[model samples]
Target: MANPEQRPIGDVSVPLNTGDVRGFKKEMGRLLEDPLGGAERLDQFLGLNIYTWVELPSILGILFTMEERDMIRHSGMRVWDRDSQGPDQGDQKWPMQDPGWNNQNERHRQNMSDLQWMIIRGIREAVPKGQNLGKAVSEHQGKDEALEDWLE
Candidate 1:
């Protein structure tokens, strides 16, 4: 038999429901806004973090919310204006709308990959010995699949 550690976790897909999408988006946005606070961070709380298949939908959902909220302006990313791409139109920007992060390029998505063991090691180095470190690591392991899948 394969060792438990060698076994693959079941696949998790991002749900298509709007509310779920919205909730996930909000949660991720909250995380990105501050990668160092809240119960969520109680899990694997440090790293450049990559997205996994499971996390794709929610991340995209959050990106959509940011777009709608204008929290991320396309102009800042140097994307062409929507109207500018076509004939004379209103003040809309980025004709061919796309995902953005903290008003940055989709490249921010790459941050996920950088968030690996190095980050965990960094956290271990920063925190003291008796400050719920074990609990933090345990919780983060539980969420690893979810987080990793989202990055894909």
Candidate 2:
């Protein structure tokens, strides 16, 4: 039988690498301290690897609990900014105006969204039968707010 600690990505299953996950988490922590650099590092970390993309959500689920995943999403938002404008700077150069930068920014935004979806989906999949997933997450968060609140 396949080890429970191993997750399938693409055509193969491999055991999780603690060192790689630790490095990724370290980069995530840098997001708040350095937005542009952190984003660049995260993009480079993910690269163009199919295996990384396929395994990312599962790796994230293993590395963090639902609450921690939610926090990571929030931290990413603070850095990436949903609109892609990032933190406002009156006189600063607008990197998004460049076609290349704009494309990269959009890709990053999509990546973040995808990761968020995976986290929520994982949570939903873990919910007990007949139990409302939204309520369960809200309760875990210590609130009575709607699921959208958690999503946002």
Q: Can you give the TM-score per candidate against the true fold?
A: 0.21, 0.31
Q: Positional deviation of 12 in candidate 2, in angstroms?
A: 6.6
Model 2's C-alpha root-mean-square deviation from the true structure amounts to: 17.6
Residue 7 alpha-carbon offset, candidate 2, angstroms? 27
Q: 26-99 in candidate 2: lDDT tens per residue? A: 65643224434444555555554323333555655655666655655454433334334534331121121222
The alpha-carbon RMSD values of the candidates against the true structure, listed in the order shown, are 19.8, 17.6
* Stretches of model 1 off by over 4 angstroms after superposition: 1-16, 24-33, 38-152
lDDT by candidate, in order shown: 0.35, 0.45
Residue 118 lDDT in model 2? 35
- The true-versus-predicted C-alpha distance at residue 79 of model 2, in Å, is 13
